[model samples]
Target: MIKIHLSRLLGERRLTQADLARKTGIRPSTIGDYYHELAERINLDHLDLICEVLNCTVSDVLEYIPSHKRKK
Candidate 1:
């Protein structure tokens, strides 16, 4: 499973979803979806923009955990 750590990163950086959306030139709704992990799939271009605005790598916002590796 893919986990989005956007909320965690934003909280740590004291950034709001609207703030990030403005900085990344992305719509707040779209950013919200990503933040809440409600989107069916993530857009890489949007991810790049987010990383650029946040000044962080993709790993800072996302994590991949295989089913076998998931905690019981």
Candidate 2:
């Protein structure tokens, strides 16, 4: 399963969806969707903006966790 860890990251930074939206020039609704894992896809440009605003790398924002069946 592809999971979004945005909520965790935001919690760690003590930032709200509104804060990120204002910083990234992204809509609050869009940020909310991403926070809730409702976004089907994200643009690379948007990702870059998010990373810059959050002062984090792509890896910090996202991680690939192997499925339980595929885990060693």
Candidate 3:
């Protein structure tokens, strides 16, 4: 599973979904989707924008875990 750590990053940085949307010029709904880890797919451009805004690398935002390693 691909896990998005947007919620954690935002909380650690004291940022809100609206704050990210304003900084990155991404739609608030889209930011909310990522923030909640509800997005099934993500645009690369959007990912780039998010990383830029968060001052983080892609790995800081996303993580891949093998299915066998994931808890049910």
Cα RMSD (Å) per model?
A: 1.1, 2.3, 1.0
Q: Identify the candidate with maximal lDDT.
A: 3
Q: Deviation in angstroms for 31 in model 1?
A: 0.7
Candidate 1, superposed: residue stretches over 4 Å from native: none
Write down the lDDT of every candidate, Cα atoms only: 0.90, 0.85, 0.96
Clashes of each: 0, 0, 0
Better of 1 and 3 by lDDT: 3
Worst 10 residues of 2 by lDDT: 63-72
Q: What is the lDDT of residue 6 in candidate 1?
A: 91
TM-score of each: 0.91, 0.83, 0.95
Local error of candidate 2 at residue 64 (angstroms): 1.8
Ten residues in a row with the worst lDDT in model 3?
63-72
lDDT of 3 by residue, 1-72 (tens): 999999999999999999999999999999999989999999999999999989999999999999989976
Candidate 1 residue 22 C-alpha distance from true site, Å:
0.6
Where does candidate 3 stray beyond 4 Å? none
Best by TM-score: 3
Per-residue lDDT for 11-32 in model 1, tens only?
9899999999889889999999
